[model samples]
Target: MYRKMVLIRRFEEMAGKQYMQASIGGFCHLYIGQEAVAVGIISALRPDDYVMGTYREHGQILAVGSDPKAIMAELFGRETGISRGKGGSMHLFDRERNFMGGDGIVGGGLPIATGVGLAIRYRGGDQVCVCFFGDGAVNEGAFHEALNMAALWKLPVIFVCENNLYGMGTQVTRASAVPDLNRRVSGYGMESAHVDGMDLLAIRALSDDVVAECRAGRGPWFIEAKTYRYRGHSMADPATYRTKDEVEEWRVRDPISIYEKQLLGAGLITDEEIRGISAEIDAVVDESVKFAEESPFPQADALYDHVYASGE
Candidate 1:
């Protein structure tokens, strides 16, 4: 869990740097402070389970076992990218891995995840579909509609909401009428709970239980992960809405640092081991950047190729 969390943190740090350097185009949302949410949830998932997420999905993709080199190449719009350079930061897909996509639309992934859950049941498979979205998305009609249908059908799906205090610029208190986002699926008659997103061990344990329940033909569940993002909603947003002190407060509970402290306190990892792991992750990130740099950008004619549907 510590290694997985660290890798995501370092990967996003490098991604942000690259975006500032003009290597990555399009809207880039850095999942800096919410490392544990992605690491914990994804690491607990089975290999064949389906996953879908919102625009802020880079970490989710990385944590789910996607190749860093290909992911970086996709961010760079290179032909060697996972989506063949067509989808940038907000859109990534890998059917082989069952990572459906990172939808750019706010609440778009909810219904799609429900459909995936339905499909799995239709095929008589026990695989669970995990849909990750932000606090802001739960208020959308699609979210309510999807959950209602999923609950009615008893679909094997889990709705994980990463509540990072604010939705873009508006705080949850100002945006949501309910405020307690854990109740998102309550009206739909689905089981739900709130979890400390910063605690990796707790998140992993709960996620494991959720997966098990869903795989056993139980109804859908919803999770309200109390997480926060250090960066703005997008690379463009300056995040002037929140105060400096508020940001610092959340920084102190940073998932990576908190997890590191736990590892140290438990005598599970030496200080030297932590440094070694950091160095290893840095090297991997450096290699990914190099791979993206050496890769070719898609040609203009290549655009026309994937544009039309081939009648199978």
Candidate 2:
């Protein structure tokens, strides 16, 4: 878990650097501070279970076992990318891995995740679908509609709201009528939990138990993970809406640092082991960047390849 978080941290750092260097195009949202939420939730998911997330999803894709090389390649707009470079940063799909995609539209993934849950029920399978979205999406009508349907049908879907306190530059209090997002879920008669997204262990334990319950056909559970982002909504904005002191306060509870300290105190890991993991992640991230750099961009003639037919 430490290694995975470190890898994602370093990956985002490198991606941000590359974006600043003008090597990568398009909007890029970093998952720097919210690594624990993605890793912990994904760790609880089964291989056959589905995972869906919002635009801030590089870590989510990686957590669900998408190759770093492929993800980086996609960001680089290279043909060998997970979506053949067309999906860019927001959309990453791997059918074999059961990762639906990281939706670019706010609250877009909710209905799709509910559909996946419906499919599992229709097939008489126990597979669960985990929908990850930001607090911003809670205001979107789709979030409420999807939850209502998921609850009414008892579809196996776990809705995870990663509440980072802001939607782009707008604060949650300024946007949401009910800042307590879990309460919104309760209106639909869905079970919900408010959680510490920074604490990986807490998320893992709760998600594990909830996932088990959902897989057993008792679900459409909701979890509001109170977390924060270390960076702005995108690389473009300076994040002037929040203060340095606020950022520093959250930094003290940096997921990786908190977990590392816990691991050390519990005798679960030595300092040297932690350092070794960091070194290994650095190498992997380096290789991933190189792989993306060496890869080719999509061909011009391939634009119409994956286009859907009219089905007439």
Candidate 3:
């Protein structure tokens, strides 16, 4: 778990650097502080369980076991990318890992997740679909619609809201009529709960119980993970809306640091071991960048490919 979080942190840091260096084109959304939310929830799931995420999804994809090299290549617009360089940062997909993909539009993954749940039910499969989105998405009509249908059919889906206080520059309090997002689940008659996203263990424990229940047919649960993003919404934004003091306050409860403290307190790991893990992850991130740098770009002739399904 610690290694996974470190991998995401390191990967995002390198990705941000690449984006600024113009090696990675398009909008790049770094998943810096909200590592625990993705690591915790995805780690507790079965390998076959489906996972969907929003545009800010590098961490989510990584947590589901996607290759770091392929993800980095995708961000670099290389042919060896997971999406063959077409999807870029916001549209990462790994079908073989049951990582459906990341959607660019806010709340776009909601309805798709509902459909996945419906498919699972129709196929009489026990697999659950964990769909992740931000706080801003809850206000979208698609959110209500998707949840309503999922609740109605009792779909095996866990809708996780990564409530990171701000949806871009706008604060949740200003945008949401009810700041307590889990309470909004009352309308759909779905089960809901809140968890501290910085506490990876707590999130993992909650995920295990909820995923089991959902797979057992008492499903379509909602989880509001109270998390904070240390960086701006995207590479373009300066995040001038929030004060430096507020950011520092959240940093004190940094997910990686909090988890490290817990592990040390429990005598589960040593400082030396932590340093070793960090070194290993650093090497991995460095290699991913190298792989992306060496990989080829997609050819112009291939543009029409994968555009439509073949009749044969």
Candidate 4:
């Protein structure tokens, strides 16, 4: 789990640098410090199980098993992207892998996941659908509607809210009436819990339990993973809303580093194994960058293609 989290953290770091260099175009959001939440939750799900998330979803896609090259290419807006360069950073989709997509609208994926759960229930498929979102999205109409329907129907959808303390520049307290975001889910009669997002083992354990419950037809669980992002909401913002002290405080509790310590202390992983995994992730990300650079952009006439299928 530590190695996996490290991979995500490093991948996001590289992606951020690439975005700054203008190599990667379109909207880019970094999941630099909040790696454990995605890695732990996705690790608990099966390959056939569906996964969905918001724009800050590179980690989610990779953790759920999307090809690194394809995702990087998507960021570069190349034709070889997962969504054929149509979705860019926010709309990564791979139906073959059961990763529905990374939606752009706040809480937009919730309704989609609810529908997926409905399909699974209707077809008697035991596959669970895990939907990821930010704390900011909890206030959206789609969030309320989806949760209400899922709870009413007892849909097997695990709502994993990555509460990174802020929604863009807005703080959770300012945006939400209730700061205990997980508890708020209970208003719709859904079982929910708040987990330490920086601790990978904690997240993995909780997710495993919740996913198992959902698989057994005991569903509609909401998990608020308390996390923190190292970077500003986006590249454009200077992050003046939050102080340096706040950023440093979260950095001290970085999920990747903290999990590495725990794993090392628990004898779950050795230092050499950790270093080797880091090197591997570095190589893969570098390869992805090179692949993105060498990939061809979409043709001019191809713009009208894939908009709507023609009778021809």
Please name the candidate that would achieve the greatest lDDT relative to the true structure.
3
Model 4: residues with Cα > 4 Å off, grouped in runs: 309-312
State the TM-score for model 3. Answer: 0.99
The true-structure Cα RMSD of candidate 3 reads 1.0
Model 3: how far residue 274 lies from native, Å: 0.8
Candidate with better TM-score, 1 vs 4: 1
Decide which is better by TM-score, 2 or 3.
Answer: 3
lDDT of 2 by residue, 103-163 (tens): 9999999999999999999999998999999989988989888999999999999999999
Clashing pairs in 3: none
Ranking by lDDT: 3, 2, 1, 4
**Cα TM-score of candidate 4:** 0.97
lDDT of 3 by residue, 9-44 (tens): 999999999999999988999999999999999999
* lDDT for residue 198 in candidate 3, whole number 0-100: 91
**Which lDDT values do the candidates have, in the order given?**
0.90, 0.92, 0.95, 0.89
Off by over 4 Å in 2: 309-312
True-structure lDDT of candidate 1: 0.90
What lDDT does model 2 reach? 0.92
Task: Name the 10 consecutive residues with the lowest summed lDDT in model 4.
Answer: 303-312
Residue pairs in candidate 1 whose N, alpha carbon or C atoms collide under 3 angstroms: none
RMSD of each: 1.2, 1.3, 1.0, 1.3
